[model samples]
Every structure is written in C-alpha cells, then in structure tokens.
Target: MLEGIRVLACGARDAVRLCATLLERAGAAVERTASDSADYDVILVSSDFDDANVVARWKTSGSHMVCDITATGPQDSRAGRRWSDAQIQAMSGLMDTTGFAHGAPVRIGVPLTEISAALYAAAAIAAAVRVKRMRGIVQNIDVTLSGCAASALTTFLPAAFARRAVGRLGNRHPACAPWNAYRTRDGWILICTGTEEQWRKLKQEARVPQLDDARFASLAERVRHVDELDALVESWTTTLTTDDCTRICESIGVAAGPIVGVRDLADEPNFRMRHAQAARAMKAHGVDADTYRDVSIFETSALSDALPVAKRAVPCERGANAAPLAGVKVIEIGQYTTAPLVGKHLAALGAQVVKIEPPGGEAARAWSPGQGGTSYFFALNNTDKETIALDLKQESARAYLRTLLKDADVLVENLRPGALAKLGFTREALGAINPRLVYCSISGFGMTSAYPSRPAFDTVIQAMGGLMDLTRADGAPVKIGASGADILGGQAALFAILARLAAREENAGAFIEISMQDVAAWCALFAAGNNSARGQALACLDGHIWMEREVSDAERAQCSALPKAVAAVKLAGATPVMRVDELLQDGDFLADVLSAARDANGAFWPVLKAPYRLTKTPACVRAAPGAPQAVRLAPPAPARAPVPEDRPA
Candidate 1:
C-alpha cells in the first residue's frame, strides 16, 4: 500500500501520535510539524488545540485536503463555499462526542473514539489527494469530539431515541441483576452471568444448590430473588479468595472474573501472551514496538489484544498561538450557581467575563465560609472573572448594561423563568441591542410552559426528575451528594452556547435556552427503563452511606416501631447518621449494627436525614474589607433616650 501521498499530522500528544502511527502503517509519507508547514497532500490537525488563528493561517496556503482531529468543531471562519465528499464525510464524523451529555457533551474516557476519527480523517485526506491529482478541488473538513462520542454511543441511541434512559451504573449492567462486583475474602470479584446457562453454571459452582429451586431457577426467577441470591453468593464469596472463586467459576463455564486491583498485568502469563502478539504487529510497522507494550501493563487479556498505545502529547502551552477565545468578551448576568458557572468556564478559557451581581451582592455571598470570608461557592464557580454590582431594576444600571451589551459577544443569565423578559431584557430586545451577541437563558424548567414557573433547587429537581426515586432502592428518595443537576446543566448551557457560536449564520443573536429540570429528566429517563426492568424496590439501604443528617423526632418515632436491633437511634440528640467518617471512628457501633442488621433478616437501619443543618445566627454576619456588609439588627434604644430627646427639644 506504499503510495506517493503526503500526510501532515497536527494534534495534541496522543491524537497526533495516533494519526502519525496510522498514516505510517498505511505506507504514506508522514510529515510531523510543530507548525503547519510544507505543501503536503493531506493535513491533519488536533481538535484539542483550539488555535483558530493557526488553522486560519494554514487554510490560506491550502494545497492539500484538511482534516481536524480535535474534540471541538471547526471555527465558523474555517467554512468555505466548496468542499469535497471526503471532507464532508470526515466533518460529519468529527462532530460526534463534542457536545454535553447533560451539559456540553465532553469526550469522556481516553478519547479512544477521537483517535478513530483522526484515523478516519487521515484516510479521507489520502483519498482526497488521489481525487485532487486527477480532478482539482482542495477539501476542508471539520471534525468534532462531540460527534465522535455520539457515534461511539450509537448502539445505545436506539434506546435513547426510544426515550430510554442511560446512565453511569458504576460497574453494574442493567440487563443482568447479579452481574456485578461482590466483596470476597481478599478482594472484590466481578460476577457476570448474562445468559441462563451461565447463571445455572455460576450457581452450581458456588455450591448454592438452593439456587436450583424453582423459586430461583430461571434468569427471571434469579433476578426476582436477586437479593436473597446475592446474600447467599456473598456468604460463599466472603469465605474464598478472588482467585479461588474465579477458578471455581471458570471450571463451571460461568462468566466470572476478579476485579483487577493495582497490579501490573504484564506479570500475568495471559497478559504476556497477548502483549507478545501485539508487539509483533507493531514491529511490522516502522513505529516503536515498545510504544504499545508499555501500556499493556494495565490491560486485561480477557479483552482483545488490539489495545492502542497511550499518546504522550504535550499539554497546550500558555499563550500558545493566541488563546482560542482571546478576544471573546462575555457579559454574565446571573447569580447563585448555574449561569455564573458557565461564565466561569468561559473565563477559564481566556474570555473576558464580567459578572453582573445584584446591588446587595449575589445570595451565594452569604454561603458558608472556608478560609477567608469568601464562600467556597464564589471561589469555585466565579474564579477568573470580574464582578460588578448592578441592579437591573434601576434605569442607570439598565443603561449601563445596555452599553455593556453593545460590545459583548455573549450574555448568560439564569433568573427565574419570565424574570428576564419582565425586566425588558428579552431575546428580541437584546438582539436589537446587539445582533451579533449570543444570549443564553438558563432556567429551572425550560422557557416553555411545562414547568416554567416551578421552583427548582438541585435537591428539588433531583426529587422531581425521578433521580431521588431511583437512587433509594427502598422507595425513600434521596438527592445526589453533589449538585449534579446544576453542574451538568451549566455544562450543557456552555456547550449549547459554543455550538450556537460556531453556527452563528443568521446573525440575529443566537438564543440558547438550557433547563436544569430538562437535564435532570434526561438523566432520569436515561437509566429509568433499565432500572425499571430490574423491577426491584426503589428503596433499600444496602449501599454505602453517602451522607448523614440528624433525624427528626417524627422520623425517630416511625423507626421505633421496628425491632429494637434494627431501630434507628439518635446519637446525642443527633440522628445516628451512618457516615463513612463516623463509621470509621466508631467501628464498634458499625460492627454492632452490621451484626444486628445481618441477624434481623436483612433489616436496614435508618440514619439521620439531612447531611448538613441550615441554621441562622446574628454573630456570624460580617463584612469583607472591600465588599458589601450584612445589615445588622440593632437592639432597642434605652427608654431614657426618648426622655433626653424630649428635654433637648
């Protein structure tokens, strides 16, 4: 396959290396460039490197077909009047996983799919060159990471399009109930018995003859009795080492494997065999055989030996070819968390973000302190941005905001639904003020009427979205420890804004609306069908305790009705919330509870309710040196002051 084609590979460390490796394998002359130089027949650029200026500069000479390998879509500036089929195909594939999942879709994991796209792009360029030699049109391609990730998830799309929900199950597969990791004597082992035959084999291997009983025979029956079956399996597993269990399961022809700990797979004979075969393939090419072997130390031979070598691409240097968004100015008109966070991300990426806070400052300013008076909220989300106090209600402030809008490229806000319009800052008004501006309106629900006016805190949204419902296997709803909804929504808003910016052809100012509720619903539905298929109770306190809250008297009274051993207790008036920290400190209590719950036929103990208490205290109020201070409630003046004032008059 040795050809007369030339390939120019420009990508971040790993992506660049993969492009070069693939092209070299195809027997094409590969030219590595720190900068885009030489009139090659094919040019490959990294997607992670967002230096649009460099891309623009390279496009000028445009002798060869161009393909981007980055996770992001190409800039609007890169678009041209004419493009080839090869270029269009490459661009279509590149836009894969570059957007937000719930937020702006990001290239998760090792960007393995991006590598695939880069290879595809490289192939397209080579084809384009062959066409150009006979015919005469230079092709330009736009590749995006979002599109790549989306394509990778295409198999799941059938379910997604069917409105089936998907989510991170940690290590559990939805279809198989007992197909999960279980604690063993020494370590954990993943037990996957997807087929009925495998399930039968696994039960027999475990020596649990009771599993053969009609009540727990078939896959459906086993799943129905999963709780009891799991207990029996765990009882046997905890007595044997992971190796012992694995060997036993393997002999019985069951799909079972030990969870790999922090151990080198290179030492394993199976891993060594696979590595040797992979090395031979790598050596056939001009690439260093050892490049692929080093990462083999982490591979499990149970999978294929076609593992790609880890790329050692250098991190993007600061001020490297001018920041992608160096001249981009963003006007942030939001408070609390979601909208402000989007601006924070933009600011981090070198955008001039001007935070417009309320006259009394944002409500988050009064949030709990860390080191200084600065709340963790402000520090975490508002970093790398300038804050300015402005009350939109005031004509002076509104006029000032209008002035700011005139020069701004984007406006981000997350007031309650209809609040923005009520303030006369509607999309039409903003578009009229600055037709080129990108306006992002973040709301609890969408701008639409479904739940436009419903109040949506992170906790409330989680509850309403069925997340809380699904989390509690026992039917008790619980909010996620982190404010997942808000953060993910913020990320989604950012991605949406970027997409709008890239495809801003209409120029009437792109109006982007992101709903926190919608994101939560999406997440809920993603995993809902699979979870529902399992048909398990929604509430079961069998997992790790993520948080602890003090139990109320009413809750305590309710728990008192249970057996004494399983009854919930209040620890010094604070509900006995079983937190990991507390469990570690009071091992005796943990052991006691474990014994009690185990003996009581698997009854769960109720812990404290809320993780943290929200209390108000006057003494805690203080003012920062430069920022506004809290207003104090003064004590009543002495009665004598009235008499003194009367005498003075």
Candidate 2:
C-alpha cells in the first residue's frame, strides 16, 4: 500500500496524465509539476518536450527516485555523468518511439512496450523509495522506449534476419513434408502429418493402399516425391469439399482442419472465448475514464486457486456523452481492405467519414458477391461513411483536396510509397495547410527501407515476413487463409490515429505513420517463438497426402450386404424392428449401418424404426404477390477533391 509515497509527474500531456493515474491507483498522492520539487518521493517525467529548464531544476534535488517516459535514449547529465534514479525514469517515454522508418524515424503503434516500461519505472521508484527510507541513499532508474522495444525483440529481429539474409522459405520446412494447405472442392484445409505414425494413419483412413507401396513407403521417400504426392492428394481433394476432406482426414488421426476466414473465426467457439477474455480485460482497464487509466495485473498464483476472484467492475460508458471526434471530420484517401477499414471503424464510432475514390471509384466497388448492386466492399468497410469521386492527379481535384483538408481533423492515405509526395501532398504541405491536423500515412513498408520504392501485397508480405515459414506444420509453408497482415495493419493505424488525436490536444500537429511490413514482422516473431521452442521448421504445401488403407475383402463384403437389406425394408414400407433395450444401448449401430449402406451403393440410407419420422419437401420456394422488392444500390461516386475551406487549423 503506497501510503507514505507521493509522485510528481512531468512530461507530455498524455504521459503526465498516465503517470498521475497510475500513481493515484497505487494510493499515492499525485501532483502535476513542470519542475521537480523537494517533497515528492518520486518524480516521473515525460520527455516529448525539448525544454531543459525542468531537468536543470531537478538536478539539485537528492534522495528521490526519478523516472523518465521519453522516446529519447537514456538520459545523461550535461556533465556526461549518470543522473539519479528519479532522473532516469523521466526519460522513458521518449525512447519508446525510436525505430526504423521508411523516410523518417517512425514510432510504433500503441506504444505498448512504452506503457509497460513506464509502469515498471513506477515499481522501481517505489522500491527505491523503500531503500532510501532504510539506508538514507536515493537511487535513480532509467527506462527508455527504445530499450523496452529492443528487449521486446525476443524473436522479431532474428526472424527478420532469417527471412532476408538467411534464405527464407515459404510454408515448407526443409525437413518435413505433407504438412500444408491443399485445395479441396469448395475451399482449403490445413493438413499436418508431422510423424510417420500419423502419416500412416492418414493414409489408412483415406483408403489409399498405394501410399504404403515401397516407392512412396517411407517418410524419406515421401519427402523426395512430395510434388507427386501433392498432385495426387489434390486430385482426390478435388472430388470432396473442404468439410468432407477435413472430416475424413481427422477421423483417422491426421492433424487437419479447414482454413477459416476472419468472419468464420469471429463466429468460432474458441475465438469467442478468447475475445470474451480480452473484452473483459479491456473493460477492467477503466477504458471509459475521461482521463488515462491502468489495467489490473493478473498473477499466476491467484489464477491457480480453486476459486479465482472475479474481475473488477468494467469502466462506465466511454462514448455515451458524444463522439470522441464529434466536431472532427475525416477524408479517407485509400482503397482495398487495409486503408479503408480505418475509416470504417472511425465511422462506426461516429466520426464523419468521407471516402474519396478515383474516377472509376475504388477497385473494391467492383469486387464480387454484391447485393442490391452494392459490393461487399461498399457494404462492409464503407458503412456509415459518405463517398465522393475525384482525380487527385488533376489540378482541379488536387485543389479541392487541399480545400477539404482545410476543415478536416484527420487525413488518411495509403498510396504507394512515394505517390503522396508526387501528388504534392507531402507532410510539410499538409501540415502547412492545417497545423492541427493529424496526418496518418499507411504504407506496405516504412519509408526508410531500401525497398521503400517497391510495392507489396498481403501475400508478398506474408511470404517475406516469415509468416509463411512458421505456418508450415511439417515442412511446407502455407498462407493463412485470411489477410491477417492487412487487417492487423489497419487496426494498428486506427490505434496510432487515436493516440495522435490525444497527443494533438497539446502537440496539435502530430504525424502518424504505420507500415504493414513491420506489423507482419511482429506477428511472425510471435509465431517463430512457438516454432523455435518445438525445434521444428515450417510446414510445406507440396508434400501433403491424405489416404487410407482398404478394409479386408471379407469385412467389405459383409459391410456391402447391409444396404440391400435396409433398402428392401424401405421398399416394403415395413416398420423396422428395434428393441427398447437396443435403443437405450450406448453403441453406434446406426453409424455402422449407414457406413455399410454407403459402401454398398455409394450413398447412405437409413431404415427408420418406430421412434423416428421423416418428411420431404420440394426445393423451390414460391414468392407471394406484393413481396418487397430487393433494393438495388447505386454505384458509389468517385472521391471528390477536398474543399480548401475544410482544412484543419
């Protein structure tokens, strides 16, 4: 219980707010200060500001723990000596944003590690205060975002190096095969056969005795002839749907599953369970607080108890009063899923989102599975948003965009790496137009990369970033069915935009940039950690096989004879016989009988007994008169040029 402790927070507006909130939660008296004071037990400084007056003033103080929340590296006294504990912690905030950028040094999204570092800094200060009370000597602690991010690089940097210079492989592990995604009749399924036993079981279950033949008999031989195996597997899978293939493979003992899409995952039981936990944690973080907040830390010991404590009450309504961007307007200058999704979320939260498309409108407008003349693109990402058409390459359109930016609170774009500057809307130009505007730039790679000029798609990034490598279960790499990198990048952009908006309250002209490549690398790092611990390489798609051994001829004949008996019973319109005790018995006689029928005539038929009833209906549906007509939506208009008057101040 921090009963005797006090905290002095100094830094950027948000950092100060966060420090103060954390201190208050720990039961410390929090005071906002521009300069360090003698009475405080801890001084937390946020380092966005360039002014040195505060540091100069704090240097004279002794016997206090210091923490810095800055993106700048660890601080050193002007004399080139290390500062006290309190002084070091104050600069932790600035160090969080240090990283590689495409054109300029860019900050990461969410500053997650930075926030964690700040909390650790607080804990260190508290420990130091205890020591000073006992030994009468104050200590200093330094936490930098850069250092924290570097420490967080447990797997990311290594994986990145492995991909570029170390010779990256897609979904295949050099050692394992038959462990990748394969196309089925309707979709794809991920098949994993990591062991010889599992592989044999898979072949036995698929009823393919040829897999056990000498030439393709051993795992080594299978690896040597993976292409042939994959071709055969694909040919068989072409006759079955994804569900059918997965069921047949899994029943025998192969590790296999259908490749699920994002929407499909959202509805899955496991995803729902995880999401519920995450939602609960978010709520407990006091997200509804008008100011900053802290989340509760969970301990393993507490979780291991028979009866775990309930989570804290969730924060109250966050956006109940009004929109967070109530007076703000946004102009979305992006296409496809990644860039446009940012505007979509903001629009859902009540921002006035205006989607600007080119003369032909966004390519997504013509994407398939349209309803009422509305593409899934317009319906999904463009919901609650307005659409306008404009050709930015034309002087008139460019002039209009400048006008629109005049009143806009945020301008978001995801053009090719250099397209924005070529269009004369450089960061300087836009900042000049609206000093308070938050300009968010999204690109495939950061501006500082050698390949900054190169274009990238989700698949390419997935391959290059090591996602395809780690996703391989046996030896072949396979792409995740969904465009995970693109979607996560969009979420990252939204998160960065929100933080910048908060920062803009004080710093007014903050620029936010996000790279899809970085996002992919981060995700890959997480996957690689799992792979490294298992000491296995990625799975490959080319060596997958799904087969099963044939049943004995005697058994097969007996199984094949049951279908005729069942059919005769059905044709006679006779009530199938069944004892009540037989019905109560816990055996799969019905399934066996059905299988026998399928074996006999290549179709399943069941003879219903007294307890069961069946009904049939025509497939066609008749429409009633005066039925409501399906409404056909018109094509979205091209994006309009920004009106100069709307530029941000």
lDDT of every predicted structure (CA atoms): 0.47, 0.46
| Candidate 2 lDDT tens digits, 76-112 | 2222222211122112211111211111111122323
| RMSD per model, one decimal | 26.1, 26.2
When summed lDDT is taken over every stretch of 10 residues in candidate 2, the lowest stretch is 610-619
* Regions of candidate 2 where Cα sits further than 4 Å from its true position: 1-320, 530-649
lDDT of 1: 0.47
lDDT of 2 at 393: 73
Model 2 TM-score (2 dp): 0.38
Which 10 consecutive residues of model 1 have the lowest summed lDDT? 610-619
